[model samples]
Target: MSKKVAVLVAGSWGTALASVLAANQLDVIMWTRGEDQATEINNKHTNQRFLPDAELSPRIQATTDMAKAVEGASAVLIVAPSSAMRSVAHQLKAHYKPEMLIIHATKGFETESLNRMSTVISEELECEEGRVVVLSGPSHAEEVVKRCPTTVVVASLDKASAEAAQGLFMNAYFRVYTNRDMIGVELAGAFKNIIALGAGMSDGLNFGDNAKAALLTRGLAEITRIGVEMGANPLTFSGLAGIGDLVVTATSQHSRNWRAGSLLGKGQKLDDVLNSMGMVVEGIRTTQAAHFISQKYGVQMPIADQLYHVLFQERQPRDAVEALMGRDPKTEMEVMTLETWEQWHS
Candidate 1:
């Protein structure tokens, strides 16, 4: 008998994951917030709004009924955007079975609460920390659905949950690695989008690959610095979720974050850029949330801070870049190896 898995949400990432599970011969049901999408999937095996070119598998079913989606499924994967995670989790809370494993594929911290996606899932579902897991990396929905080579990480405070998620998603083209650093994984996944925006901005300015590469390297440094201060293992930022994801997001034409940043660099207003994209660019909200958290936590998040200024305060992109370049010089490993502020070492 095939294992039953329910994937909530019907966006590109959600549909792609469902397709992967169905390809693995799992009994998968894709739950959508809209009846139209569910009907389209059930009748035509296509989600026209997203993934129009790709056909869904016969084994995969689509439905708008939340109860039917959750009931009797061995595991549930939440792929909604971070903005909707809390609501979706709350709606599923009453129906979540104790034995049913839950994992989140969404990345980004909540703007209002600044809570990571896993934290939102655990808190809303009243589940033990062990029951929740997070899967994130450089796996874009378009590439994953096409069976392109992709690697990602599954992380949880509980080892079993991480392993279970890895077992559920690993296949020939889609490889999953297990990690215990949930905070680091989540933060790395969420915060990298912000840097991707910076990278995109560099591209929009017609900066050479050298400039983009510099932004990426320094962006990883900033992400690692903040993640380490937040009790995350610094090594996690050096792995798939950190530099790996950054490379994909910062360089790919498929990245919505990069596209949005490109527009911003071209002098488009935030609202204008968002309206033009027609899809959720997770980086915009994430930039604000990261900025808030860095201020609250006193982490040195210069990239996120400048991105926030550009998005909200009407700061010019070139000026932001200038400000970043003009900052005080510091060693590359200062955040990682330095002991005290007063330690004088060049």
Candidate 2:
């Protein structure tokens, strides 16, 4: 008998991951709110709205019943939007089993609670946060559905949970790495979206490659500062969840946050920009959360702070750029104390 895996939601990312699980000979059942979507995936093996051109495997199924989706499944993958995570996790709590592995691929925080996805899931499911594995990196759902080569990281404080997630998701076309820095992995995944928005704004303003390169480089630096201050390993910022994810999201046309930022950069109103895109722009919400977080943590997040102004305070994007450029000059190596990074150079 094949192992059963339950995937929450039928969004593009969730559907793409379901395909990978099915390809691995696992029984995949996707739960979606729309009964029509469930029927289409169950009968036609297609999710035209999300993965327009991809065909799902027959081994993959869809259901509207959350309980049925979770029933007897060995692992449950939550790919809901960050805004929906808390409520979805609450619903899952009814069917959550102690032995079932919980993995979340959602990036972004709960703006209200300022909680990580795993933290929300653990609270809802009444499990330890360490048991929830986070899967993130440069992987895009569009490329993954086409069976293109993709790599991602699965991280957890629990070594067994991370390894189990790695084994479950790794494949010939999909490479998975295990990391112990769950805090770094999660924070890096969330914070990089802010920089991607910055990169997109740079492009939309017709700024050339030089400008974008600087923005991305400096953007990475600012996020690293804040992530480290938030208890993440500074080295994680240089790894897949940091630079890797930042590069892809900031550069790819497939990134919603990038597209959203481009619209804002072109002088579109925030509401208009958001209405133009049908998907959730995680970076916008993330910028808001990071704004408060940076203040609370006493970290200097120049890029995220400027983004907060542009996104919520109606400040012009170009003006935000100017503010960033006009900031007080400081040593480039101020990201950490000498003792923290001395080991690397020595």
Candidate 3:
């Protein structure tokens, strides 16, 4: 018998993951927050607003009822925006089952608590340490549903959790790797969005490709620095969740972060840009969360700091870039390794 997997997402990415699971022959039930969306999925077998071109599997059901969605689910994939995670968890509390393995596919931090998606799920659901696994990488929702070749990481503190998650999503085109560093995985996934914005700004400025390349490279450096300080394995940043996701989000037109950054760079107001998209541009919220994390942990995330100032404080994007470029010159890794080492020593 196939395992039943409940996917909590109402957006394109959520639909894509559900499609992948259902294609793999799992009993997939996708839960959207709205009855209209659920109706569309259940009746039309297509999420018109999100994945218009792709057809969902008949095996895949949709529901707006949280209880029905969670019931009898052997595994649950949390793919809602970072902001909604806590509230969703609260709703799931009464129906929580010990056998359910929760996989977090969302990639943002809670601005209010600066907690990673997995951390928020653990706290809100009272999950055991290793029960919550995070799935992250360079996979884009648009491409994944098409069965384009994609690779992702399944990270958890427990080897078994990672292995179990790997078993759920691994396929010929969809490859899954396992890692033991949950902190690095989650941090790398969340922080890369902030950097992708910086890259997007470079594009909006019409700066040459050289500038975008520099921004992406340096942004990874910053991400690794903060991730290392927060007890993440620095090496993980070199892998899929860190540099890989950054490259994809920063360069691709499909990235909401890059799109938002492009608008900001073009001098559009943040609110205006977000209003135009009609979907959650997660980087906006993640920027605030990363900004707080940087200040709280004393991590020198120049890109995040500058992006935060630009997005929230109304600083000009050009001015933010100028300020960053004009900063006192030092060895690129000068402050990075030292701070990480110091944190380790302390």
Candidate 4:
């Protein structure tokens, strides 16, 4: 029998990943809360709302029932938004099997606890932390659904689990790599969204590529700094989950975070920007969490700090840019502590 993989939602990213599994000749069952959406995918083989231009594989199926989705499945991929991850994991607990592989592609921290997605999943599923694998990188759903060439990393402390996830998702068009730095991967994925929002704001304010380039460069520095302090591998920040994902999210028109920041740069109010987005901009909430996290870690994240002020304190976007530019002069590498430098060099 073909391997069966269960996807816990029919959102764009989830649907795209299901299609990738189906392309590998796996039977993919996608679960959604909306009956109409499930019916549409089952009948038309297309999730028009999330993935409009692509035709879904016949091997892919959809159901509204949670148990039905996970029944006898070899793997389950949870792609719910960060805010919904805990509840969705709880819903899957009754049906989840210990032996079945659990993978998640959600990006962002829990707002209240600032926990990574894998941590949240393990806590909710009552599984070992190593049992929860995180799949993340530069790929966007809009492109993935179309079989565009993409690469991503799956990270778990358990190498076998990470390799299993890699095998489950790997195909000609979709390449998956394995990494053990789950902390770095998850943090890099979540933190890059904030920088992406800042990049979009730069463009929206008519700032040229020079500004965007600078943001991307300095953004990686601060992200790596905090990730290292939080027990992540510094080198991981230079990999796919770091500079690679950062570049794509910061510049791509498909990024919802970038779009939200663009709107803010264009002078839209927070409420109005969010309402017009019609999607959860992860960066908005991540900014809130980053603000608290920077304080907690005593890490100076000037860009994230400026972004937090713009996002929460209602500071004007241009003024925020001015503040960033007018900060006290310092060396470019000052963000990386001497200990971090020694660790990286020695």
| lDDT leader | 4
Candidate 3: the clashing residue pairs are: none
Candidate 4: lDDT of 38?
92
Q: Which residue segments of model 1 deviate by more than 4 Å? A: 337-346
For model 4, the superposed segments whose C-alpha errors exceed 4 Å read: none
- Tens digits of lDDT, candidate 4, 237-298: 99999999999999999999999989899989989999987778999999999999999999
Model 2: pairs clashing at backbone N, Cα or C within 3 Å: none
| Displacement of the residue 87 alpha carbon in candidate 1, Å | 0.2
Residue 310, model 2, lDDT: 94
The C-alpha lDDT values of all candidates are 0.88, 0.91, 0.88, 0.93
Best of the two (2, 4) by TM-score: 4
Query: Where does candidate 4 clash, by residue pair?
Result: none
How does candidate 1 fare on TM-score?
A: 0.96
lDDT of 3 at 3: 78
Q: What TM-score would candidate 2 get against the native?
A: 0.97
lDDT of 3 at 165: 91
Q: Higher-lDDT candidate among 2 and 4?
A: 4
Q: What is the clash tally of candidate 1?
A: 0
In candidate 2, what are the lDDT values of residues 50-74, reduced to their tens digit? 8897999998999999999999899
